[model samples]
Target: VESLGRDGLAMAKSLNMGNIFIRKKDSNSLVPNCEKHGVKAFSIEAGRALKLDYDYADKMVDGLLNFLRKVGILEGDEETIESQSVYTTKEIVPAPISGFFKPNATLGEKVKKKQRICQVTPFFKSRPKSVSAPVDGKLIYLRSEEVVSEGDSVAHIIR
Candidate 1:
């Protein structure tokens, strides 16, 4: 599992995308399910839901070709990938109330635990609740839309 994860990270680095290696596997995910049966597998999550990123698609093709060669599945010279940064999203910052969300921290920035990440003001003129980071980590995800419902995930922190 670790070997394939490193290769996946390498593929990401070779493609010039943000490199990530998720250390913990969820039992419901395909990779973990396959692992249970002694099958080596890795999953590639790319692009966005209901959207096709053409530029990323092209690079992914090249990266897959290189990966195939590296694994002896294809006959060609394989490219060596540089060391990559490994991180995992373990926590998500949720909106405290359905309201307009105002982010206090920028995405990709490192934040400390208990640092205020965003504020969600209630629609009925109530006091805004501050949403904070639960751990010291890099801000990995943030909602782009301003409006958020209570309990909706507004951001994620990966360490």
Candidate 2:
């Protein structure tokens, strides 16, 4: 059965969208259940939580239409791109200590293992906690809020 939660990277490459694989294993979720049941399902996180970006919406619509065409479910041409980025290896780097997070890596930036991605300064006067990359990958997401608590997700990396 196709992992729709589709072969995520495949759909992204076909539609030329920002290809990010959501890693959620050993958890209760519908996507995985669909896979087990042989139901071809797909999941996509379109814009931010509340706000809507019309341009992004339009792009996604176009991609969906093109995907239909590419699969022969619809007529006409497909606008498949030459090469698209597929970010896999999902890693959520958590804050080691409760403090304010100061990021050293920007989103979409490539980082190496052991590289300082951010530092959390404690509320009390003391040395800040050094947050380093656990693996060599691209920095995909970083928390916007500076105030962080222990074990909070500070960064997301994908290889």
Candidate 3:
């Protein structure tokens, strides 16, 4: 169990997944494999470990479509992903002032620079002050139910 190599780790050896979905299965191998009387084939590359850009997502979709087409699992369009907003990571929005944040806008929302996207409470208090975007981009994530100690990522700008 502990001596398995990184590539040799098993996720699920089954004929079917049966409505169960497992994320981050590669990190823990034996935990994902359960039950008896079924085939055991591990899909090593099931998900991503880090944030993905539009290009990466497109490539992944294309690869999956091709694989499914080859195996006769899917018969449809060749999978065309059109990204409405594709921005480079170089255009990021940094925290102006660190504090307990409460996001006002949702992810993928187009925001302009200097527009209020979230607010920060000095000590998790009521009536928080707003934090504006430094660059025009889509908000990716907001620190959900987390305690940020200052300059710790309140929201992401994807311009």
Candidate 4:
């Protein structure tokens, strides 16, 4: 059961993207099949990008190796792999009215409460309505689509 992870969602490719959940019994069956074939498998959720941090990539590799060791595919001491905890309290900023969105904040940038995050200008109007952050947090993602409907999600903030 392969699926696009959170990175795909960050790219705006799919609406439902995150960790994949499997029933415990199903997972029990799946693990043995992978073990029999000497395959180590796991899932990860991350942001979308053309390039990734080298340090993060290395850590992922180390984590995979540790998983292999735990599942009997390899024999070694369990290596400690540190991972950054992801904050899940996300704020989905919605469009106040249908318009073309001009974002002021970049992805992964820190934002303060009440900061202007974007502006939405209706196609027929010259004035744009400014959107502000409701809480202090980091900008997790911004909508790639310029045109949006009223109440559509314009950006996501992680507090």
Candidate 5:
């Protein structure tokens, strides 16, 4: 598991923003082979609701232990692991024109199809273009940069 800010931007280590979940078996069945070589693997992506804290650390540890148990590497009672669904399809909203971006929704919030999520106002005198959600899903990422160029990714909604 790895933590990243909205828009997949690298954040300070202290900030536990979100996680990227890549399945161990989604590709070439490498996870099983790696395990034969004494390596462990996971296939879930988790996003924290807050910054790095004791609660977050504890949850991580518990998740690790539970995973080990599930794979028969550790012996223990079965525990239900709460996790977020992995989304293969993502709606990436790009800037329509060069401008300053102002966001209308918080990161990780649920958005409906066609919802207005942000606006891009050009540095000059042109009108601002409102950015809308393309699908009903969770807003996984939003650009933190104030200025954006045309075609720059502004938001990502996972469905």
Candidate 6:
């Protein structure tokens, strides 16, 4: 198994490794072979293979329990961690079009489904395009306001 960067995929294809799991964010639903030609393709979280935090063993066990519960390997109280939340990297929102993104909400704000989250406008233009939360979540970040191209990450919503 190798890291799934651009060069890594090129190398994997050259060697004919039938199954490759690219990082979820790197995949494109548009490419048909990206799904069909590979024997298997998926993504795994970063902390799945390592300790989430070295200081707290209890937190580690709780994290493992969360995974087991997710995969149906173990079952118990559905709300074991009432305050805990987990999010994938894909939850990070990117600009749909090249523009200047201005967030109306601050980070860590609890947002409901369909609530306005941010606004974006083309560079040097006046009118803004409002971006909304697709699901209930908390705003985790607002990437700085330098410049964002189409598909460039502008914020993250942790649901």
TM-score, one value per model? 0.70, 0.75, 0.47, 0.56, 0.60, 0.44
What's model 2's TM-score?
A: 0.75
Sort the candidates on lDDT, descending order: 2, 1, 5, 4, 6, 3
Q: List the residue pairs that clash in candidate 2.
A: 3-6, 4-41, 5-41
- Highest lDDT scorer: 2
Candidate 3 residue-wise lDDT at 105: 81
Query: Model 6 has how many clashing residue pairs?
Result: 0
User: Residue-wise lDDT of candidate 4 within 1-159, one digit each (tens)?
Assistant: 124355422322111222223222245566557856998443454545565767767755676666556555779865432333335367889999998999998987889999999999998999999999999988877887889999999888876
The lDDT of each candidate is 0.77, 0.78, 0.52, 0.68, 0.68, 0.58
Which ranges of candidate 6 are over 4 A from the true structure?
A: 1-90
Cα lDDT, model 2, residue 134: 96
RMSD of 1: 3.5
Q: What global local distance difference test value does model 1 have?
A: 0.77
List model 3 lDDT by residue over 54-119, tens digit each. 775665566655545544588863332322232335244445555666777886687888898877
Q: TM-score-based ranking, best first? A: 2, 1, 5, 4, 3, 6
Model 1 regions more than 4 Å off: 1-18, 36-39, 51-59
Q: Which candidate leads the pack in TM-score?
A: 2
lDDT tens per residue, model 6, 87-145: 43326677877787777788668888778878788877788888777778767667666
Spell out the clash pairs found in candidate 6. Answer: none
Clashing residue pairs found in predicted model 1: none
RMSD of each: 3.5, 3.5, 11.9, 9.9, 9.3, 12.7
- lDDT score for candidate 3 against the true structure: 0.52
lDDT of 4 at 69: 63
lDDT of 1 by residue, 1-159 (tens): 364465566654554335564757778889889989999776676644677879878877887787777777889878756665567555878887899998999977889999999999888897889998999998867777889998999988888
Backbone N/Cα/C clashes per model: 0, 3, 3, 0, 0, 0
